[model samples]
Target: MQRTISFADKPTLHGTNVLLRPVQASDVAASLEPDHEADRLTGTHPTPGGLSVEQRQDWYATRADHADRLDLAVIDQATGLYAGEVVLNELDDDNQSCNFRICLFYSRNRNRGLGTEATRLILAHAFETVGLHRVDLEVYEFNPRARRVYEKVGFVYEGTKRQALRWDGEWIDAHVMSILAEEWAVHRGYPEAPAS
Candidate 1:
Protein backbone atom coordinates (compact mmCIF):
# COMPACT_ATOMS: atom_id res chain seq x y z
CA MET A 1 0.00 0.00 0.00
CA GLN A 2 1.23 3.48 -0.79
CA ARG A 3 1.79 5.64 2.26
CA THR A 4 -0.18 8.86 2.33
CA ILE A 5 1.33 12.20 3.36
CA SER A 6 -0.05 15.04 5.46
CA PHE A 7 1.95 17.93 6.93
CA ALA A 8 -0.83 18.97 9.27
CA ASP A 9 1.00 17.62 12.25
CA LYS A 10 3.78 20.15 12.42
CA PRO A 11 6.53 19.00 14.76
CA THR A 12 8.77 20.74 17.20
CA LEU A 13 12.11 19.24 16.34
CA HIS A 14 14.89 19.84 18.81
CA GLY A 15 18.66 19.86 18.34
CA THR A 16 21.68 20.99 20.30
CA ASN A 17 21.71 24.45 18.73
CA VAL A 18 18.33 24.90 17.07
CA LEU A 19 14.63 24.20 17.54
CA LEU A 20 11.98 23.72 14.89
CA ARG A 21 8.38 24.55 15.65
CA PRO A 22 5.24 25.64 13.85
CA VAL A 23 5.65 29.10 12.36
CA GLN A 24 4.02 31.87 14.37
CA ALA A 25 2.93 35.40 13.53
CA SER A 26 5.61 36.88 15.76
CA ASP A 27 8.27 35.66 13.34
CA VAL A 28 6.98 38.08 10.71
CA ALA A 29 8.81 41.12 12.02
CA ALA A 30 12.16 39.38 11.95
CA SER A 31 11.46 38.06 8.47
CA LEU A 32 10.71 41.54 7.12
CA GLU A 33 14.29 42.61 7.66
CA PRO A 34 16.17 42.46 4.38
CA ASP A 35 18.97 39.93 4.07
CA HIS A 36 20.61 40.79 0.76
CA GLU A 37 23.16 38.02 1.21
CA ALA A 38 20.41 35.49 1.80
CA ASP A 39 18.50 36.61 -1.28
CA ARG A 40 21.64 36.37 -3.43
CA LEU A 41 22.65 33.06 -1.93
CA THR A 42 19.20 31.54 -2.38
CA GLY A 43 18.64 33.06 -5.83
CA THR A 44 15.47 34.75 -4.63
CA HIS A 45 14.32 37.90 -6.40
CA PRO A 46 11.45 39.25 -4.39
CA THR A 47 9.19 42.21 -5.01
CA PRO A 48 10.62 45.68 -4.56
CA GLY A 49 11.41 46.44 -0.90
CA GLY A 50 10.37 42.94 0.09
CA LEU A 51 7.10 42.09 1.86
CA SER A 52 5.11 44.63 3.74
CA VAL A 53 3.92 44.07 7.30
CA GLU A 54 0.33 43.37 6.28
CA GLN A 55 1.21 40.84 3.61
CA ARG A 56 3.60 38.95 5.84
CA GLN A 57 1.16 39.14 8.69
CA ASP A 58 -1.62 37.48 6.70
CA TRP A 59 0.74 34.88 5.26
CA TYR A 60 2.22 33.68 8.54
CA ALA A 61 -1.13 33.90 10.28
CA THR A 62 -2.50 31.25 7.98
CA ARG A 63 0.44 28.85 7.88
CA ALA A 64 -1.50 26.26 9.81
CA ASP A 65 -4.45 26.26 7.44
CA HIS A 66 -2.45 24.47 4.78
CA ALA A 67 -2.33 20.73 5.21
CA ASP A 68 -0.46 20.04 2.01
CA ARG A 69 2.90 21.42 3.15
CA LEU A 70 4.94 21.68 6.32
CA ASP A 71 6.42 25.05 7.32
CA LEU A 72 8.43 25.30 10.51
CA ALA A 73 10.23 28.14 12.14
CA VAL A 74 13.89 27.64 13.09
CA ILE A 75 14.81 29.11 16.43
CA ASP A 76 18.37 29.59 17.59
CA GLN A 77 18.78 27.87 20.94
CA ALA A 78 21.40 30.28 22.16
CA THR A 79 19.47 33.45 21.42
CA GLY A 80 15.94 32.02 21.47
CA LEU A 81 15.09 34.05 18.39
CA TYR A 82 13.50 33.15 15.09
CA ALA A 83 16.48 32.42 12.85
CA GLY A 84 14.77 31.04 9.76
CA GLU A 85 12.53 28.33 8.34
CA VAL A 86 12.67 24.78 6.90
CA VAL A 87 9.93 23.67 4.53
CA LEU A 88 8.83 20.47 2.83
CA ASN A 89 6.40 21.10 0.00
CA GLU A 90 5.22 19.95 -3.45
CA LEU A 91 4.35 16.58 -2.04
CA ASP A 92 3.82 13.69 -4.40
CA ASP A 93 1.88 11.00 -2.59
CA ASP A 94 2.14 8.27 -5.20
CA ASN A 95 5.87 8.76 -5.52
CA GLN A 96 6.19 9.33 -1.77
CA SER A 97 8.41 12.31 -2.35
CA CYS A 98 8.63 16.03 -1.68
CA ASN A 99 10.93 19.04 -2.09
CA PHE A 100 12.87 20.61 0.77
CA ARG A 101 14.12 24.15 1.30
CA ILE A 102 15.54 26.22 4.14
CA CYS A 103 16.62 29.81 4.74
CA LEU A 104 18.07 31.80 7.62
CA PHE A 105 17.03 35.42 8.07
CA TYR A 106 20.41 37.09 8.60
CA SER A 107 24.09 36.56 7.96
CA ARG A 108 24.67 36.33 11.69
CA ASN A 109 22.90 32.96 11.56
CA ARG A 110 25.20 31.55 8.87
CA ASN A 111 28.38 29.41 9.13
CA ARG A 112 27.44 28.14 12.59
CA GLY A 113 26.04 24.70 11.76
CA LEU A 114 22.59 25.95 12.68
CA GLY A 115 21.28 25.42 9.16
CA THR A 116 22.82 21.92 9.07
CA GLU A 117 21.13 20.88 12.28
CA ALA A 118 17.83 22.38 11.15
CA THR A 119 18.05 20.49 7.86
CA ARG A 120 18.64 17.18 9.62
CA LEU A 121 15.74 17.73 11.99
CA ILE A 122 13.30 18.37 9.13
CA LEU A 123 14.60 15.45 7.04
CA ALA A 124 14.15 13.13 10.00
CA HIS A 125 10.54 14.18 10.36
CA ALA A 126 10.08 13.78 6.63
CA PHE A 127 11.48 10.27 6.21
CA GLU A 128 10.66 8.83 9.61
CA THR A 129 7.42 10.46 10.72
CA VAL A 130 5.87 11.31 7.38
CA GLY A 131 6.95 8.04 5.74
CA LEU A 132 8.36 9.78 2.70
CA HIS A 133 10.56 7.86 0.30
CA ARG A 134 12.44 10.78 -1.21
CA VAL A 135 13.21 14.47 -0.73
CA ASP A 136 14.87 16.69 -3.33
CA LEU A 137 16.18 20.22 -3.77
CA GLU A 138 17.72 22.55 -6.32
CA VAL A 139 20.66 24.73 -5.35
CA TYR A 140 22.13 27.39 -7.59
CA GLU A 141 25.76 26.83 -8.58
CA PHE A 142 26.92 30.16 -7.23
CA ASN A 143 25.93 29.09 -3.70
CA PRO A 144 28.24 26.17 -3.07
CA ARG A 145 28.12 26.39 0.70
CA ALA A 146 24.41 25.64 0.72
CA ARG A 147 25.04 22.70 -1.60
CA ARG A 148 27.73 21.40 0.73
CA VAL A 149 25.30 21.56 3.61
CA TYR A 150 22.75 19.56 1.61
CA GLU A 151 25.39 16.97 0.67
CA LYS A 152 26.44 16.64 4.29
CA VAL A 153 22.84 15.74 5.08
CA GLY A 154 22.94 12.87 2.54
CA PHE A 155 21.45 14.52 -0.58
CA VAL A 156 23.33 13.21 -3.59
CA TYR A 157 24.01 15.19 -6.73
CA GLU A 158 21.66 13.99 -9.46
CA GLY A 159 22.25 16.46 -12.31
CA THR A 160 22.21 20.12 -13.20
CA LYS A 161 19.62 22.43 -14.69
CA ARG A 162 21.55 24.80 -16.91
CA GLN A 163 20.64 28.49 -16.77
CA ALA A 164 18.12 27.71 -14.08
CA LEU A 165 18.52 31.13 -12.56
CA ARG A 166 18.90 34.50 -14.26
CA TRP A 167 20.52 36.87 -11.81
CA ASP A 168 22.43 40.10 -12.20
CA GLY A 169 22.47 39.85 -15.99
CA GLU A 170 23.97 36.32 -15.87
CA TRP A 171 22.55 32.84 -16.05
CA ILE A 172 23.47 30.35 -13.31
CA ASP A 173 23.08 26.59 -13.18
CA ALA A 174 21.07 24.97 -10.42
CA HIS A 175 22.20 21.62 -9.10
CA VAL A 176 19.57 19.03 -8.44
CA MET A 177 20.03 16.77 -5.42
CA SER A 178 17.99 14.17 -3.56
CA ILE A 179 18.04 11.63 -0.70
CA LEU A 180 16.14 8.39 -0.34
CA ALA A 181 14.46 6.93 2.74
CA GLU A 182 16.75 3.90 2.77
CA GLU A 183 19.76 6.22 2.63
CA TRP A 184 18.39 8.24 5.51
CA ALA A 185 17.88 5.03 7.46
CA VAL A 186 21.62 4.46 7.17
CA HIS A 187 23.14 7.89 7.76
CA ARG A 188 20.27 9.62 9.59
CA GLY A 189 21.61 12.84 8.01
CA TYR A 190 25.35 12.06 8.25
CA PRO A 191 26.63 10.81 4.88
CA GLU A 192 29.05 7.87 4.89
CA ALA A 193 30.23 5.17 2.55
CA PRO A 194 28.75 1.71 3.07
CA ALA A 195 31.29 -0.93 4.05
CA SER A 196 32.84 -2.50 1.00
Candidate 2:
Protein backbone atom coordinates (compact mmCIF):
# COMPACT_ATOMS: atom_id res chain seq x y z
CA MET A 1 0.00 0.00 0.00
CA GLN A 2 1.20 3.51 -0.76
CA ARG A 3 1.46 6.12 1.99
CA THR A 4 -1.03 8.41 0.32
CA ILE A 5 -4.58 7.89 -1.00
CA SER A 6 -5.50 8.66 -4.57
CA PHE A 7 -8.40 7.84 -6.90
CA ALA A 8 -7.54 10.55 -9.40
CA ASP A 9 -5.79 8.22 -11.81
CA LYS A 10 -9.04 6.41 -12.79
CA PRO A 11 -7.12 3.18 -13.33
CA THR A 12 -7.85 0.53 -15.91
CA LEU A 13 -7.57 -2.77 -14.03
CA HIS A 14 -7.70 -6.04 -15.95
CA GLY A 15 -8.85 -9.50 -14.97
CA THR A 16 -9.14 -12.70 -17.00
CA ASN A 17 -12.85 -12.07 -17.50
CA VAL A 18 -13.36 -8.33 -17.29
CA LEU A 19 -11.61 -4.97 -17.63
CA LEU A 20 -12.23 -2.14 -15.18
CA ARG A 21 -12.01 1.30 -16.75
CA PRO A 22 -13.38 4.78 -16.25
CA VAL A 23 -16.95 5.11 -17.51
CA GLN A 24 -17.86 7.74 -20.12
CA ALA A 25 -21.01 9.22 -21.67
CA SER A 26 -20.73 6.81 -24.57
CA ASP A 27 -21.31 3.99 -22.08
CA VAL A 28 -24.73 5.37 -21.22
CA ALA A 29 -27.23 3.25 -23.12
CA ALA A 30 -29.90 1.69 -20.85
CA SER A 31 -27.80 2.58 -17.83
CA LEU A 32 -30.56 4.94 -16.76
CA GLU A 33 -33.28 2.45 -17.52
CA PRO A 34 -35.09 0.82 -14.64
CA ASP A 35 -33.76 -2.60 -13.79
CA HIS A 36 -36.18 -4.35 -11.45
CA GLU A 37 -33.87 -7.13 -10.43
CA ALA A 38 -30.95 -4.81 -9.94
CA ASP A 39 -33.08 -2.50 -7.84
CA ARG A 40 -34.37 -5.35 -5.66
CA LEU A 41 -30.92 -6.84 -5.12
CA THR A 42 -29.40 -3.50 -4.17
CA GLY A 43 -32.52 -2.52 -2.20
CA THR A 44 -32.67 0.73 -4.09
CA HIS A 45 -35.88 2.70 -3.62
CA PRO A 46 -37.12 4.28 -6.79
CA THR A 47 -38.19 7.92 -6.62
CA PRO A 48 -41.11 8.15 -9.00
CA GLY A 49 -39.25 8.17 -12.30
CA GLY A 50 -37.74 11.57 -11.74
CA LEU A 51 -34.22 10.50 -12.71
CA SER A 52 -32.64 12.81 -15.29
CA VAL A 53 -30.94 11.10 -18.18
CA GLU A 54 -28.93 14.21 -19.01
CA GLN A 55 -27.73 14.48 -15.45
CA ARG A 56 -26.73 10.82 -15.47
CA GLN A 57 -24.87 11.41 -18.73
CA ASP A 58 -23.08 14.39 -17.23
CA TRP A 59 -22.18 12.27 -14.23
CA TYR A 60 -20.70 9.57 -16.43
CA ALA A 61 -18.97 12.14 -18.62
CA THR A 62 -17.09 13.50 -15.63
CA ARG A 63 -16.22 10.34 -13.70
CA ALA A 64 -12.53 10.83 -14.50
CA ASP A 65 -12.50 14.20 -12.77
CA HIS A 66 -13.12 12.88 -9.28
CA ALA A 67 -10.13 12.31 -7.04
CA ASP A 68 -11.83 11.22 -3.85
CA ARG A 69 -13.66 8.08 -5.00
CA LEU A 70 -13.07 5.28 -7.52
CA ASP A 71 -15.81 4.38 -10.03
CA LEU A 72 -14.75 1.95 -12.73
CA ALA A 73 -16.85 0.55 -15.52
CA VAL A 74 -16.79 -3.25 -15.70
CA ILE A 75 -16.24 -4.34 -19.30
CA ASP A 76 -16.56 -7.91 -20.53
CA GLN A 77 -13.27 -8.93 -22.11
CA ALA A 78 -14.66 -11.34 -24.69
CA THR A 79 -17.37 -9.00 -25.96
CA GLY A 80 -15.56 -5.73 -25.27
CA LEU A 81 -18.83 -4.33 -23.97
CA TYR A 82 -19.84 -2.48 -20.83
CA ALA A 83 -21.06 -4.90 -18.20
CA GLY A 84 -21.58 -2.71 -15.17
CA GLU A 85 -19.68 -0.70 -12.55
CA VAL A 86 -17.74 -1.22 -9.36
CA VAL A 87 -17.30 1.71 -7.02
CA LEU A 88 -15.49 2.76 -3.85
CA ASN A 89 -16.97 5.88 -2.42
CA GLU A 90 -17.57 7.75 0.87
CA LEU A 91 -13.86 8.01 1.56
CA ASP A 92 -13.05 8.51 5.19
CA ASP A 93 -9.49 9.71 4.75
CA ASP A 94 -8.78 9.99 8.43
CA ASN A 95 -9.61 6.32 8.90
CA GLN A 96 -8.32 5.25 5.49
CA SER A 97 -11.56 3.46 4.61
CA CYS A 98 -14.26 3.67 1.97
CA ASN A 99 -17.68 2.25 1.12
CA PHE A 100 -17.99 -0.22 -1.77
CA ARG A 101 -20.68 -1.09 -4.31
CA ILE A 102 -21.05 -2.88 -7.67
CA CYS A 103 -23.81 -3.43 -10.23
CA LEU A 104 -24.03 -5.13 -13.63
CA PHE A 105 -26.29 -3.75 -16.39
CA TYR A 106 -27.70 -6.86 -17.96
CA SER A 107 -29.12 -10.30 -17.09
CA ARG A 108 -26.60 -12.14 -19.24
CA ASN A 109 -23.89 -10.80 -16.92
CA ARG A 110 -25.31 -12.37 -13.76
CA ASN A 111 -24.42 -15.72 -12.12
CA ARG A 112 -21.21 -15.88 -14.18
CA GLY A 113 -18.62 -14.55 -11.70
CA LEU A 114 -18.45 -11.03 -13.14
CA GLY A 115 -19.41 -9.43 -9.82
CA THR A 116 -17.01 -11.63 -7.92
CA GLU A 117 -14.07 -10.80 -10.18
CA ALA A 118 -14.98 -7.13 -10.22
CA THR A 119 -15.16 -7.03 -6.42
CA ARG A 120 -11.77 -8.66 -6.16
CA LEU A 121 -10.15 -6.25 -8.61
CA ILE A 122 -11.45 -3.07 -6.95
CA LEU A 123 -10.64 -4.29 -3.45
CA ALA A 124 -7.14 -5.05 -4.68
CA HIS A 125 -6.79 -1.50 -5.91
CA ALA A 126 -8.24 -0.24 -2.63
CA PHE A 127 -5.93 -2.00 -0.23
CA GLU A 128 -2.86 -2.85 -2.31
CA THR A 129 -2.48 0.09 -4.66
CA VAL A 130 -4.68 2.90 -3.29
CA GLY A 131 -3.37 2.65 0.29
CA LEU A 132 -6.66 2.20 2.06
CA HIS A 133 -6.61 0.59 5.48
CA ARG A 134 -10.11 -0.88 5.09
CA VAL A 135 -12.98 -1.23 2.67
CA ASP A 136 -16.56 -2.02 3.70
CA LEU A 137 -20.01 -2.59 2.26
CA GLU A 138 -23.60 -3.31 3.24
CA VAL A 139 -25.78 -6.09 1.88
CA TYR A 140 -29.41 -6.57 2.65
CA GLU A 141 -30.41 -9.97 3.95
CA PHE A 142 -32.65 -10.61 0.97
CA ASN A 143 -29.62 -10.54 -1.29
CA PRO A 144 -27.69 -13.64 -0.33
CA ARG A 145 -25.81 -13.75 -3.61
CA ALA A 146 -24.07 -10.43 -3.01
CA ARG A 147 -23.31 -11.34 0.58
CA ARG A 148 -21.69 -14.55 -0.57
CA VAL A 149 -19.56 -12.68 -3.08
CA TYR A 150 -18.32 -10.33 -0.41
CA GLU A 151 -17.53 -13.25 1.83
CA LYS A 152 -15.61 -14.96 -0.99
CA VAL A 153 -13.49 -11.84 -1.26
CA GLY A 154 -12.60 -12.00 2.47
CA PHE A 155 -14.98 -9.41 3.92
CA VAL A 156 -15.85 -10.29 7.50
CA TYR A 157 -19.34 -9.85 8.80
CA GLU A 158 -19.36 -6.92 11.17
CA GLY A 159 -22.98 -6.87 12.31
CA THR A 160 -26.52 -6.35 11.17
CA LYS A 161 -28.69 -3.27 11.09
CA ARG A 162 -32.08 -4.63 11.99
CA GLN A 163 -35.16 -3.57 10.09
CA ALA A 164 -33.03 -1.41 7.88
CA LEU A 165 -35.11 -1.62 4.78
CA ARG A 166 -38.82 -1.98 4.05
CA TRP A 167 -39.75 -3.63 0.79
CA ASP A 168 -42.64 -5.74 -0.50
CA GLY A 169 -44.35 -5.40 2.90
CA GLU A 170 -41.58 -6.86 5.07
CA TRP A 171 -38.60 -5.38 6.87
CA ILE A 172 -35.12 -6.52 5.95
CA ASP A 173 -31.83 -6.53 7.80
CA ALA A 174 -28.75 -4.99 6.26
CA HIS A 175 -25.48 -6.74 7.01
CA VAL A 176 -22.37 -4.67 7.35
CA MET A 177 -19.16 -6.32 6.17
CA SER A 178 -15.57 -5.12 5.99
CA ILE A 179 -12.06 -6.16 5.00
CA LEU A 180 -8.83 -4.64 6.26
CA ALA A 181 -5.55 -4.13 4.46
CA GLU A 182 -3.86 -6.75 6.60
CA GLU A 183 -6.46 -9.37 5.72
CA TRP A 184 -5.92 -8.59 2.05
CA ALA A 185 -2.24 -9.24 2.58
CA VAL A 186 -3.05 -12.79 3.67
CA HIS A 187 -5.83 -13.80 1.30
CA ARG A 188 -5.55 -11.17 -1.47
CA GLY A 189 -9.13 -11.86 -2.58
CA TYR A 190 -9.78 -15.55 -2.14
CA PRO A 191 -9.85 -16.45 1.54
CA GLU A 192 -9.31 -20.10 0.68
CA ALA A 193 -6.97 -21.29 -2.03
CA PRO A 194 -8.36 -23.45 -4.79
CA ALA A 195 -7.55 -27.14 -4.89
CA SER A 196 -4.34 -27.93 -6.75
Which residue runs of candidate 1 sit more than 4 Å off their true CA positions? 1-3, 48-50, 193-196
* lDDT string, candidate 2, 1-196, tens digits: 4426778778899999999999888778847566889988888887886557787888889878878888899999989988899999988887899999999976888889999999999998898788999999999998998989999999999999999999988999999999999999988998978756
lDDT against the true structure, each candidate: 0.90, 0.88
RMSD of each: 2.3, 2.4
Model 1, position 193, has a per-residue lDDT of 53
Relative to the true structure, candidate 2 reaches a TM of 0.94
TM-score of each: 0.94, 0.94
What is the Cα-based lDDT of residue 181 in candidate 1?
99
- Residues 1-196, model 1: lDDT tens digits: 3336878787899999999999888889887767888998888897777667887878887989877789999999999999999999998888889999999988899899999999999999999999999999999999989998999899999999999999998999999999999999998998855666
Please state the error at residue 181 of candidate 1 in Å: 0.2
lDDT of 2: 0.88
